[model samples]
Target: MSNIIAIDSDIDRLARKLEHEARLFAARSRNAEAPRSRSWIVVDLEFLFDRSRYEAYSIAEGKDAEEKIRWPFHQVAAVCWMKMEFVRGEPVPMIEGPFVLAAGEMNERAMVSALFATLENNPDAIVTTWGGEARDLAVLRRAAATLDLQLPHQLIDGSPYARERLDLCRATCVQADSVHLPEMAAAVSVPSKPSPSKKIGVLCEAGDWSAVRDQVLADVLTTSVLAVRHLAAHREIECHRADTMTAIADATLSAIPTSGFARKTFAPWARGEKAASQLRGVVYRAAA
Candidate 1:
């Protein structure tokens, strides 16, 4: 009986491996034939959790204290998504968002549900993220389950869209496990985090919801720029076109009527602009 059980377990493991491989092969074939998605949804989430408690629990369990909590113990502090629409013949994409939901202003379950609704409503847009596949999506899945909410079909089991997720960490990072969003964005000349991640949690703890919102907004903007750069790298758009789209993105942010949050969040990017202007001026003067 023991021998039979061992053999059955081995067979089940092998079957699962084969099924996963089969799905991968099918996904690859479909990707090769499908045209690139013109509509893109770039998303990022910020969570607030009790770090001290998590650390104490992990140490007691003899696990790495630094390991991110996999359970839905964290509250969704903010959820921000930027929608970019690419016209067939346009050089620069149009930006529709930076739509944000904050926990202080809304219930946690409602925030998570809003994200699911966004996915369901924009079924055709390709959802893009930095470490979304492993981090953001994992937390979202657990959060939805805990909240007793039904996930969108796009994120549901066996959904082809779920398999087709564009995780930039995997797509652009040679060392996906080690590379972070700031490093990846820097590599492509995109604006990075406005403030340290540690500060986000600190601000949340102090009930500085606006400050947390600023940090979340900054992250989403960085991710949005990175996504456009990825398209250029893949030859979906021209390099100059990517630059134009980025400038347009900057303009959109500037036009938004917000508090000092927007100004502070975008300051780092302003330095980049100044540097670029200096370089252009040098080239033009030298040519005169």
Candidate 2:
């Protein structure tokens, strides 16, 4: 495990170096106007997962697939971005994506090319992400390398990019005791990722791709919100309730409807129906 991490770090280093020349060209041709403001770019990525019966499209996917058995089988589904800048010295935030750049959506080369193109337009942009330095960026960097794609100059370490890579995930991890992204965000009152509708594979296979896109959008926004709130030194937003536990186990049971219970001798129909409905809803996960 340690060796793999070290090797991945080396890959990221090489990818950054390989992209150096192209990044410069891209930065020069991009819209330089944003540099006038103190702009920071907050980004998040959502990769699609397969069941190993499919092919890996992104380097991140391949790396993930290599470790897992017949599970995981990951691929780059999309990338999302949120831009925050000081306009007239007041903070303003805007969302930029749900950029679906996977191979199935379009030709893989063209999709990746467009992503880099978009990044090129923001030369002086300060890159920020939740856990980008260690995960997102490294994965993206590796993917670009695998494709022989040149990343934007800002992607390669230089003045603004490296110094300004504010990985809120890394910063908050030690403080938050390594709790996951959504938990950390919620504790600080930043809206977290919505409850996932279903497993990614199920949604993808069932042709519910829109759900995946929606999830990515929610995540990126949550990540951006968390970063902005933390930067502003916002207080912990979670309200600690005096009564934390609800006594649903001994609650009132009434009403009647269709019941899934298989009892031939049931006199009290209303009570049975209520128990069945409430019991399933509260105890088990809601039906997908």
- Give the top-scoring candidate (TM-score): 1
The Cα local distance difference test for each model comes to 0.70, 0.51
lDDT of 1 at 197: 68
TM-score to true structure, per model:
0.70, 0.54
Off by over 4 Å in 1: 1-37, 50-71, 157-163, 175-177, 238-243, 246-256, 259-288
Q: What TM value does model 2 have?
A: 0.54
User: Which stretches in model 2 have alpha-carbon errors above 4 Å?
Assistant: 1-36, 49-73, 91-104, 158-161, 174-176, 205-207, 234-288
Top candidate, metric lDDT: 1
Question: Residue pairs in steric clash, candidate 1?
Answer: none
Superposed Cα deviation of residue 235, candidate 2 (Å): 14
